[model samples]
Target: MKANDLNKWLVQERARLIDNYLNLIQKCLGGTIYEDPPLQALGSDKFDPVLREYGWDWPSMAHTMIGQKRLGNIRQLVESVLGNGIEGDFIETGVWRGGACILMRAILDAYHITDRCVWLADSFEGLPPPNEEMYPADAGDNFHTFNDLRISLETVQHNFQKYGLWDQQVRVLKGWFKDTLPNAPIDKLAILRLDGDMYESTWDALNALYNKVSIGGYVIVDDYHVVQGCKLAVQTFLAEKRLSPVLQEIDGVGVYWQVANGTSSS
Candidate 1:
C-alpha cells in the first residue's frame, strides 16, 4: 500500500479502538449517554420557560460530546484534588459560540462553586495560517477564515448572556492566543480546555498555562483526536517535556490529560 493508504488505515483503526473503549465505559457507567442538545433547544421559543432560564439551547449532545466528556472528567479530577476546598479558576483558549464555557459555568453553578471564574479566550476569527512544521499535510482548509463565519467577541459575550452567565465571573479575552494568553490574570488553573484548531494556537496556550495548571488539575485538548496536527503537537510537546500522565479518550474525538503532582514545568 502507498504511505497515504497506510496512514488512512491507521486512523480508522485508532478510531475504532476509541469507539469500542467508549462503548464499554458507557455500558459500565449505566447512565443515559447524552448527545449534545440542539442549539435551538435553548431558544426562548423552543424550550419551556424553566429550561430556557437555565440556558438550555446549545449544541446537541452528540455535537458536543468531546467537550462534555472533558468537562465531566475535569470536574471529577478537580473535585478530587481540592476535595471540598477547591480554589482555582477554569479557562478555555478557543471558544466558539461559547458553548463549552457555558457548560462549565453551569456545572459550577450546579455544584455551587461560585468562588472561581471561567475565562473565555478566543480571537473570534478562525484558524491562523498553518505552519508546515506544526500542522500535518492533511489538515486542509477546515477552519473558518475571519470572513467566512465571522464570530466576534461581542457575539460570544452575547452567547454567555443568553446562557445566564454574563456575570463578573466570566472573562472574555479578545485576541490570538499568543497575544492574549500572557496577559491573562490567571495564577493557577484547575481546568484548562484547549480547543484551538491549529498548532501555533495550541502551543501558545500550553506554554502560557500548562505550568500554572494546579496539581491534579485537568487539561483538555478538544481537537486532539480528530485533527492529526493537533494530536501531533500535543504528543510532541508532552514527550519533549518528559511529562507522562494518564491519557483519557473522550467521545472518540478528543483526549485529555490529568495533570498530576508529578507533572513537570520543564
Candidate 2:
C-alpha cells in the first residue's frame, strides 16, 4: 500500500475506534447498559424513550443524567473545538457524575491531543440554598433539596478512574463555583459548560469563567430552557456584557453559543 493509503486507512480505523468507544461511553453513562430500568420502581422493565431523550427522568446507576441530547452535545462540541483548532481546556460547572467530563477526556485521548485539560468544577455537596434576597430569580428554588444532585467528590474521581481517564489533566475544583471559580488556576477555556441549575450557580459560573473562554470557544448552558433561574441569569449576563453570540438550541432545554469578540444585541 502507498503511504497515502496507509495514512487514510489509519485515519479511518482511528475514527471507527473512537466512534465505538464513545458509543460505549454514552450507553454506560445514560444507563442504557442496564436497558434503562425504572429507577424508582423495585423491578426492571422497559425504558421511557421520552424521559431519557429529554433527560427528564433520573437514572438508577448511570454516571450522567443529561440524557442523550446533552451528552451528545458535549462530545460534538469537544470534537468541534479540536477540529477547529480552538484553544484551551474543557470545563463543566455542575458535573453531576463527571460523565460529561469523562467523555471530554476520552475524546482528547482518542485524537491523541495531549495539550488540553478537562476541568470539573462542582461543590460535590449539591446545589446551595437559594439566596433569595440577592438572587430573586432563584427565589423558591428547590434544587437544593434534590438528594440526587449531591454526589461526592470521591465518587466522581472513581467514575473517572473507572473509564481510565483520570489523570493530572483532569482537574477538580471541589467547592462552590463562587468560591472556587474566582480563583481557579485555569488560564483559558475552549468549552465552558454550565450545568448548575439555579440563578446563583449559573451567574457565579459565568461571572467567574466566561471571560476566560477563548474568543472561538463555546458556552454551553445546560439548563437554559428547563430552569428559569438559569435562563434569567444567562440573559442577564449577556445583557450586561452586550454579548450577542448566536444561540443554538439542543433538545429544547439546552443551548450553546460560540464566543466572538465584542458582539452587541438588544
Candidate 3:
C-alpha cells in the first residue's frame, strides 16, 4: 500500500488490532502479574496519564510499554524512511519480548523491502543494573532485577516465528547494549530506536550508534518521558555532539526526532 494510504489505515486499525490482541491474551492466560507493585496498588484509575496512555497500567503480557498510539507513531517513522528511499537497516536497541522489533520486520515484509534488515538488540536478561560509578544519574535504579521484564532470546525468536515473520532479514544482537552496540557489524541505520531505560544504557547506545544514522532517518527514544535517567542521557549526548533535533512526542512515554543534518543517506 502507499505510505499515505497505509498511514490512514493504521490510524483507524491500530487500536482495534491492539485491543483485540490484548483481550485474546487475557482470555488465554486468565491473568498476568504486575511488574510494578506500586502501580498495581494504585489501580488503573489512579495511574498517571503518562503511564495509562502508553499501556503501562495494563497487565504485563509483554514488557512493551508501546501501545496502539505509540505503535502507530513507530510505523509512520519506519514507513517514512522506506518511502523516502533512505539507505540503511532498521534497528531497535532494547527489544524486550520483541514486539516492537517484530512490527518493524512486519512492515518491511508488507512493503517488500528486501535490502534492509531489522536488527534486534537486547540483553535478553532485562536491563543491566545501574553503574553508579560511571553513570550517576542511574544511581538508585533497580529495573534490572525485574524478572518479568526479561525475555530470553529463544522466547523472542519464538515470538517472531509465531507471527511467521522469522527469517534471515531478522538479526539478533543478543547482549547488553553497552557490550553489543559498539562493535556490532551494523553498516548504517535508517531508524535507530532506543528503549534502554537507564542513563548508562541509553548513553552507551547514542554514543555508539548515533553517528551511523542516516541524515533523513529517525532516532526514537522509547523511555524518554517515563525514565528521567533516559531523558538525561539523551539530552546530554545531543548537547555534547552539538546536534539539535526537535523531539516529538508519541503517546505518553515515547518520543523521537529525525536526524536533520545536511548529510545524504546515499
- Listed in order, each prediction's TM-score against the native is 0.68, 0.94, 0.80
lDDT of each: 0.64, 0.88, 0.76
Flag clash pairs in model 2: none
lDDT of 3: 0.76
Off by over 4 Å in 2: 41-46, 264-266
Please say which candidate is ahead in TM-score: 1 or 2. 2
Q: For residue 16, what is the lDDT in candidate 2?
A: 97
Candidate 1 per-residue lDDT, tens place, 12-128, comes to: 986587445444333222112432234442243332322322223333322222333554554455555446454578898887666567666655654466788889888888666
Q: List the residue pairs that clash in candidate 1.
A: 35-61, 35-62, 36-60, 36-61, 36-62, 37-59, 37-60, 37-61, 42-56, 42-57
Q: Give the residue spans of candidate 1 off by over 4 A.
A: 1-86, 133-142, 146-149, 264-266
Task: Tell me which residue pairs clash in candidate 3.
Answer: none
Question: Number of clashes in model 1?
Answer: 10
Ranking by lDDT: 2, 3, 1
